[model samples]
Target: MGFDPSRPDIHLGHVVGLRKLRQLQDLGHQLILIVGDWTAQIGDPSGRSATRPMLTHEEVMENAQSYLRQFFKVVDRDRAQVVYQSEWFGKFSLADVIGLTGRFTVAQFLERDDFAKRFAEHRPIAITELLYPLLQAYDSVAIQSDVEFGGTDQMFNLLVGRELQEMMGQRAQQCFLMPILVGTDGVQKMSKSLDNYVGVEEAPDDMFGKIMSLPDEFIVSYFEYLTDAPVEGQTVNPMDLKKRLAEEITEVFHDQQAAAAARDRFERVVQQRSLPDDMPVVSLSTVSGPRWSNALVSAGLVSSVSDGKRMINQGAVELFPPSGQSLKITEDGRFEAPEPGTAVKVGRRRFASFQE
Candidate 1:
């Protein structure tokens, strides 16, 4: 019962609303996740400073597929009812639009904070854009949702749904607004456009590293919402809390074995410690490619080639020879087979093995 289906990656802001929905699901309420395909065309302007770019049907369909994949990781897909609103909204006629428009007044629409701010600053608010909230409201009426959930920034749209339900002679749905999760930048909300989000489907170590790299200010919110830790009345250190948060979130997407390994890897590399014997491993074929740096990047052991080189120069990249001997990698690149179980290390963080 919300908008913004463009990117499927759910950040902490989304986790908040989904958590509430999960709670209701636990309480035996009817919970449905409306894809909002119909509404996405108009793009919700609830928290936006400028108009959002509209997506084509093909692009929207592709992104929607990715969205559902990551969505089920957190929510119980077995008990969940997933639906696309395009069936109803996409078929609405001119009479339907006019009839729905009669439900609210322009004065009320202009009264929204984002719209008012944009209006005061002489920003362009598109005519079609104004109907977004009403369309979202219609979603609630169509589904007969008992409650609609959204972020604090989405208060206006959530209220619209509530008002629409009441006007349609149906019971008003309660608006549950969760707070936005500040992004890794510590200033803006976690967003794909800002490139600050940690995609849920990221590899185990990648997820772990991203979580560990967050600024100190974001620890509390991360702990309170992202992790399963109970933070109600407990006094906790930010460092310990982030570590726990990282572990819990990692375990959700990865197996416990991998989560434990990622924790150990992060500790050894970032905390200047030593790697545990059972740390996770990545397999690389000797004939798959050339050069250790390129191999490591291909295996996702490093963020990029530049990052791999930086780590190598800093004495972070280590090569294990066939006879179980470990040596530092050099710029004069050599392509050779490693011993039976030889491995390569990038910053004591990422590991890869040479296999025939």
Candidate 2:
């Protein structure tokens, strides 16, 4: 399928679609991605209201520079062809645009739920917006893509390609729509704009912690979609299952060593109620007596200072000294690291063990 690889940061939501691409690649099928540098200008009309804010040429170029990095984390990129849609669509003649549009009717465009919803509520729908799906379909004809993959929300646009392929005297591309993963809120689709996404570039510890915070109901679905782990008919507890799911995903982006360390820390912090014997040590040149929350953030144990406060409030941040005595750090005051092998917990799932 003509998928957009122009976005800079790939997130877990994209991993759902990439899984299908990986499957095809492993089967020795050709995989080509049309980085929608062109369609993105008009914006994809699948899920948005109004027109998307267009990217500048410089912005598009920058995103394309690193766009393929995370993709190989899931698929064999050496077997894939990555092209920019700008190569074809950038030079499309006015007559070419007209011919493509003439292939589809106004009724067909109006039937799409995104357009239908907007039209029903009198939201502005540009005529140019009607051309987005057609151009995406045209991509299939241009490249003669054998199979296309997209999220279920994009079924209409994916079908548009199938229709165009048959009309243009080429074999219709088989469309595979993968299931969508709900965001951390467990309600809406995961999106970076929603601030509910886990970026591919996120630290393993942070990613592990975020996954652990998901609702118990999402564990099985996540295991099914995101990781290579098998969750079919296992009678294990949901929380334990989620930990395994998180570990597999973390292993993909980070080294197996890091994933193991994060898992060990998670178990130590939450399950055993003990500190990790081999926790990472970060050196501070000077000690001004920074707050415990600040120390946790500096040690990469938490996402934010506010998260630090929440951890302490929940009694998850524990400090222990070499004397084997555990200390609780509360919001009202800070605790000193009394000796080597001191431990810090930012939450039940994330802990930092330190020695000065």
Candidate 3:
């Protein structure tokens, strides 16, 4: 259970592997969660088209602390032994590094898909990147782990660990690969970099909405990976299935009451086209003659004016006038002062009222 602290948050994609770790823990196996503090500086080259920026020691430690907090959300902390890879790597000397690197060859490193593609394309593969898998392999040997779990993309690295363990006269460890959870886009793997991830630490309403926004086709896989719910030999409407999936996942990170309240808020505010009772009211300095995109930014509904413009272009922004009929902001256009009690709806879950 080696997890790279490349980011500060753990998303549903990471949960797929954590769930397997939990299953192993339940079976009375000792779970070692290795925080890749040493490897984070080199970065894991798996599934990357470009060189990943290295993190500072401070950044890596900060991210590791955040990761541990979120990781325990699904895993039992008492049964899991968390360690930093620096425990061993920091003790390595120049001679030790030379000996470790000598065990593997350039040909062996290039055999990985990421490395092979870079080599064939004549891309600059950093020497540090080549050492990533080797260092990760040494982790397994140092811990003397019996089994390693990771996503399918990590198969190469996990296999390297098994080989290194056997090379050290220890039994080869078993590698268990989990299917990558698709993002909300239903295309790329769920990742925070792509902004398509549903973080375990997200607000209850936000988590619920992100799950609900997932494509209907993903309901089955979401059920199989993220929740304890049964998916086999069951037939249900895709919408109904998606709702159940959302509720089930929401309950895992949050309690059942919070999940129910979030579902109710989503139905009342989104599916039923009614405003939330506690929707935050944002006051604008000048409510009149403001660009819809700017208003959305001012109200904290969207991250930026460009994001607000994109949402408007996608017909996801609407203006609900207190007196006149509600209107969708179809174009990136400005509006005259909205009615005194007007409210703006952005996407499926966010709402803000405009006031002077």
The lDDT per prediction is 0.76, 0.78, 0.89
Where in model 1 is the C-alpha error above 4 Å? 232-237, 273-356
Predicted model with the maximum TM-score: 3
Residue 170's lDDT in candidate 1: 96
> Looking at model 2, which ten-residue stretch has the lowest summed lDDT?
281-290
Q: Cα miss at 202, model 3 (Å)? A: 0.9
**Candidate 1, residues 1-356: lDDT per residue as tens digits?**
55456765565556767776777788887779898786777787877899988887777777788888877777788879888888787788999999999878999999999899999999999987898888888888888988788888888888888888888899998888788888777888888789777777888887888887789777878877776677643567777777777888889788899899888778875687443465445554524456656666766777777776777678777876657556887672755656645667776356666555
Each model's TM-score? 0.78, 0.79, 0.95
Worst 10 residues of 3 by lDDT: 281-290
Candidate 3 lDDT over residue span 224-268, tens digit each:
898888875556678777877888989999999999999899888
Q: Judging by lDDT against the true structure, name the best candidate.
A: 3
TM-score of 1: 0.78
Clashes of 1: 1
Q: Indicate the TM-score of model 2.
A: 0.79
lDDT of 1: 0.76
